[model samples]
Target chain A: MTEQELVQRAREGDELAFAQLVTDNEKRIYNLCRRLTGNPDDGAELAQEAFLNAWRGLGKFHGESSFATWLYRLASNACIDFLRREKRRRSLSMTVSLDDEEEGRQAELPDQGAGPEERLERAEDRRAIARALEQVSPEHRQVLVMRELSGLSYAEISQVLGLEEGTVKSRIARARAALRKRLLAEGNFFGGASSTR
Target chain B: MCDCEKALDWISLDLDGALTPQERRELEDHLAVCPGCAALARELAALHRVLPELEEEVPEGFQQAVMERVRAEKVQALPAGRGRAVPWRRWLSLAAVCAVVLAGAGSLGRFWDRSGGTEPAAGETLPVQAAQAGAAAQAGAAPQEEAAPQKEAAGEGQGPELRLYTAMADPSGAREAADSGEVLPEASPLPTVGAAMNQAAAQNEDLTEAQRAALTANCAAWLQTSGLDPAEAGLLTVEAVTQTDLEAAVCPGEDQRARLDLDDYRVTLGSSDVLLCDSATLEVLGYLPTV
Candidate 1:
């Protein structure tokens, strides 16, 4: 069945139809979450919560946009909320150690290159980039992730973020500039170009 | 001015294919002559390449976990009486109850008209009547003759029993009764339901659990009357119960106040139909067909 047909059936309370919808978009949603949260476990949980919310609020899906776009909006909101709450908790408690968090994140990066030396260098480059990304503000990071990672069109990002198209374009441009500047400052981009690439 | 700043501006847009063809040509020509701009563009391209490769895979059974949660929420939202068999009998009982309450309300309207009582303002009638009935019942006085028909209707027990009482004695009558320690009669289920929903909606809170259940039940009753099968048509799940402003065009005049005012719960079912219900009386004020 077409996606619209599946959505129609799902609306009619067909569990199978809804499951099919989940199956179709799970990877993209999961990847989006993984990138946003920078943690696989947290990404999985956020992705699941987003789907559950989508199921509950499915009636509000007016089909003015594609199902994937609608789902992206929900997943994005869930990630943003999670990040906000985490930020608040960290600020309030002051118990979370940044070094420990970075160590945990380092262990999560995949190690696959032509050889051990190359792999180690690649991992270092990955860590540097990730750390730089973490330093960027959430608003800029979000637009950058949507544009570069999720590969959404500026128009699609505008709809998902509820921003004007011009706003989306400018934000994305700013995000790119910010990210590049941060990587450069950290000596991860232009400084060690030969080894990093 | 040097074309360098403009080239930098166009770099990200060029990668995104967002630059105009003319602009793209200008940037390309600038980059060819200016090795600095060309190298900057290359670095931006490399950053784009690395971002996507960083996304990691989620753990196994993620889909299973999400589906499990969805099933659990669905089961919880289903009415207690829902069974393997369709709920036609329950629908019938609901229909019968609605008929009784509506009939009783019509009769009460006629009674008021005959007694030379004007129709009270939108906010006035129910609270006043409730207070008066509470006082009269507490005093051990029999309800006036005008309430007899409604009392008989309540005795049938097929639907929500509306307590008949005098219209508000005055604008502040209900408040006065409350302050004086006069117990207000238990409001008939309909208006109390309406009042509670209106209060919650005004605060923009999600419906309380009881209110959510009532809304689901109300939607079921409406689907039955519309000749749609709640179970088969997927109208069973109450996705949302929210209060929205009624457009004057959709609901006109006093009818708008009756139907669209704070008293209406906009019940969203599954992914389709939206039913506007009078929170006070469980009346389906407006129905938007499933999209």
Candidate 2:
């Protein structure tokens, strides 16, 4: 069935249709959350929460935007809220040490099809990228992840973020520049070669 | 004419394919001379290439776990035919709170009499025989033989005397008389026991002269043992006599009555303590501090 028809069925209390919808979009939502949170466990949990929220709020969907866009908006807002709350929690307590988190991520990295050496290299590279993404401001990181990882168009991001298209475009460009600067400063980009500049 | 800054901006836009043909050409012309801007473009392109590689897959069983949670939540949200079933723990907590409030109000309700009235006359009493007669009549029984025999068997030495004191201080008589248009004689200065008995008799016609005199003596005895110096505390008037469950303040949990015997009288002692006393013997049972 078409996504809209599936959404209609899901709205009418059809769990099978909703399950189908979840099956179709869970990968993108999970990846978006993963990139935004920079923690696989938190990403998986937040993705589930986002889908659950979408399920509960399906009755309010007016079809003004595509189902994917609406779902992305839900996931983005959930991640932003989680990040803000996590920031507050970190300020209040030092329970989650940075080294502990890094170790946790390294241990949790999935074994893709890559060999052991390649997997270790890929995990290290991922850790560096995630660490750099964490350095970027949450607002800029959000725009960058939605564009780069989720591959959302500027217009789609504007719709999801409730910003003007021009604002979205400038924010995406600034986000990329900020991320590149941070990555370069950390010597994680271009195989640690000194910048030509 | 585009400077390095504009050239970098165009290059960033070109990465997104957002640059127009003219803007792309303008950036290319500037990049041809600016190796720094050209290197920045290459680094930014490489950064973009690496970012998407970091996207992680959802953990296994995540979908099933979410669906399970969703199903459980949906089941809980569904309304039962009877109504929403309150959790047992919540119901128990609510019941406990209600019991506490009721126990507190029952304890405090005796002392906080909002209806203010004049003090009962001193030295007035109600006859024991008359009280028994009234009690018998109310119980739908023939007036029993003079209560003297029963009083003796019940270990009440001065049953008539205690009855007289209780009836004289009983505010219910005065309230009843007030409602029934019986104006009690004005307080007499240095009134003798006989005069007080007459006043009690005149106020409540239901009680005999002996009952009135006994009630007066009972009131006098209560005043003596009330632990309040009359000169300092002023005249201690009886407000209302009500039956109440023994509260911890009066009767500790170990001493609390297991059943409703109704033998205790909660005597409101004129802005003083609520004195719990035996209704038959007129002995002070316990005292609850008012202030």
Candidate 3:
């Protein structure tokens, strides 16, 4: 069956169907959770929890968007709730070590031939993104994660967030703008610089 | 719309492909003449082009994690007794057992002391001793030694904790014997993931249609030779048992268990559960997970 169909079945209280859905989506869900939570253990917990949550709430699913979008929205909401609770419980962003940054570094490279300076610039760009992302509001950061990292479309974003299509478009625009501003301010991008591409 | 805001609006709607044909024409017309608006449009377009491809920072399991947390809350809202909701007959039987036990001793005997009653009388010692024996039976082989240090370790990683998947299949022969259907058994991987090898099988589409047919033939041959079920899962061996096995091995005392009902294949391993062969064989083209 299709993932969406499996998801719909899962919503209807089909445990086996939902389990299949979780299996299908586990890695992406785990990676996304890892990025958002920045801890392996917490990510694991949250990823599994998201599956269980999806299974139970599957009946309420309206099939309005891709199942992944709906599922991620649910998970994103959960992560946000966790973050808020952590903020209340302890005024920290649940300090994960620089280990996650190290992993990000590992992912920064592409296989194409580039000069040393180009590599440096790319690394710098990623670092700039990492720092700038931390500064954005959680909502803004989430929009970036959904649109950029997850590569979701505007309609998908709207469905995931329960936002109007126009609102999703605007927020995404602002989020991109905000990211650009952050990177530029950090000098990660050359202001008025000529195109490297 | 204001000229400045117009550029922003166009930039925003552009990626979504939401700009009407007329709007696109109007915007392109504006850009053709207005150098400033054009530069700004180019800039926004550049940002738009870059961001999605730029690979924004995510913690780990970005989408999966979010969906998981969402799924967890929704699951929690359901009766926590999710899959294990005992049938009505079982519940009634349990209730009857409790009622009978209570009825058998509803009296002024010294052993009748449940909470704020007087001290236990001489005769009550036997009942207390019986209760202690029952408790001891539950702790037969496992000692208190294993619990103390483990509990401390669990206490250390406390956060917005929720019971995820647990991997506490009894480490006995029965687990192996159950669902030991006839798939080819390759050499086991390091750390011995026992039954989690189904994941690799699920991934790695090198086993194309002919290969699957060959595998099915091989399985049928092996099963016929060795008296195995063709549909049976023969043996599972995972590369990294660390992910699925270790945690569940540690947490045997968990109050809640979220059983992962692996598709077709039973979730013999905790984290490494697979969508079984019956769902997607060479017979069925596979479905990709949400990336």
Candidate 4:
């Protein structure tokens, strides 16, 4: 059946149809979450939450936008909310240390070393990119994830976010600039090559 | 160099495949003379290429795990229907505790009168009481004897007092029970509670659009004081309240006394805080933070 047919069934509380929808969108949504959060675990949880929210709110989906676009909006909102809560939680908890996050991130990097020096450098570069993405504002991260990671066209992003196409265009531009600024600040721009004017 | 601002926009557009050929040519023309713009374009293009490569494999069994949670949520949502099927036992225990508070509602009424509290209008407390009683009856507890005196107290110009009683008891139980397809008393407290809320919402229509605007502004301002962006407050729900008891439940350490002239309003600021503001003034009264 077409996705719209599945969506219609899911709206009527058909779990099988909803599961089919979930199966279809799971990988893309998960990658979107991962890019937004810069953490695989958070990405996984947020992706699950996005699908669950979609299931619960299925009744409200009136086919105004494609199911995929609606799903993207939900996933983006979930990641943004999670990011905000994490910020608040971090502010509230005095015992949380920056070192803990660093240690956790280091553990996440692969230990396999086919070419010890090059592989380690590549891993460091990947970490720099992830860290730079994380440092950007959540709104910036959101548009960037949709555009770059999810391969959503500018028009699709506008529909997903309910922003004007002009707004999405400017936001994507600013997001890229913000990300570039972060990489430059950390001296990780151009894959650690020497900075050029 | 001065036109680099437009050039940067075009460069970003070019990276996204959004620029038309004309715009792309204009961007290239600008880039040829502007080293700064050229470098920025190259870096952003390179970043764009790297970003798509950052896509990670979805974890194993991810879809299955999500399906399991969805099924669990479906089970939990069943029979009682949406937003209503709470663990009724917890509400029953809360009802048991409120039953004691109801015993002293007479004195509480007097305290509000003596303290010059804004007692809600007559017949207002009946619905909330009906709600509590409905919850009690739903739990198979005989609350008739306990409900009788509170009705009399509510009759005696103790509108805010009894609603406060209901708030302390269970403001939500009545509405949820009313919405659920359960056998309830014809004058089921939950229905009365639901009707009263609906009536209140209906009355909201009677407010001139100006009044609604003022209420929204007051809510947004109060949310600002409670550490929320006023811009996002438009998305949060705002409601009028005579008492902050339920609001207090959501916002602990909220000073009820700071309420303006015995009345306050509430704004749900995400899942963390319910901000209470004075009904007449923009003064922020109290907030309940998530424990």
User: Over the stretch B267-287, how does candidate 1's per-residue lDDT look in tens digits?
Assistant: 445455666656444556776
Model 3 gets an lDDT of 0.45
* Residues B137-241 of candidate 3: C-alpha lDDT, one tens digit per residue: 112211122222221121112111100000011112121112323333333333322122223233321112233233234334533554333343322211111
Candidate 1, residue A28: Cα displacement in angstroms equals 1.8
Q: Please list the residue runs of candidate 4 whose C-alpha ends up more than 4 Å from where it truly belongs after superposition.
A: A92-123, A191-197, B77-291
TM-score of each: 0.52, 0.51, 0.48, 0.52
**What TM-score applies to chain A of candidate 3?**
0.76
Candidate 3, position B80, lDDT: 18
Model 3 TM-score, 2 decimals: 0.48
Deviation in Å, model 1, residue B14 alpha carbon: 1.4
Tens digits of per-residue lDDT, candidate 4, B1-291, equal: 226768667888888777788777878888888788888888888788667655666788998999777654532311122222222322222222222233333334432333222233323222233334433333222111223322212222222333344443342323221222322122223333223333323331121223323444555666666566555433343334434344343432335453333234444544445665544333356665556
**Candidate with the greatest lDDT versus the true structure:** 4
lDDT string, candidate 4, A122-167, tens digits:
5556556677887888899889888987889888999989999999
TM value for model 4: 0.52
Score chain A of each prediction against the true chain A by TM-score and list the results.
0.80, 0.81, 0.76, 0.79
- Candidate 3 residues lying further than 4 Å off, grouped into runs, are A8-16, A27-44, A59-66, A89-113, A191-197, B28-43, B53-291
Q: Once superposed on the true structure, which residue ranges of model 1 sit more than 4 Å away at CA?
A: A92-120, A192-197, B32-36, B77-291
RMSD (Cα, Å) for all candidates, in order, is 18.9, 23.5, 19.2, 19.0
B1-291, model 2: which lDDT tens digit per residue? 678757656666788899888878888888788877877888778767667766655678988977765553342211111122222212211122222222223432432342323232332111222222232222211122223323111112222222332233233433121122332233335345444434332332222333333433454465566644323122222212333334433542334333213434444444445555444333345556554
Q: Write the per-residue lDDT of candidate 2 for residues A45-102, one digit (tens) a residue.
A: 8999988888777867879999989999999999988888888977642122254555
Clashing pairs in 4: B130-B189, B131-B189, B251-B288, B252-B288
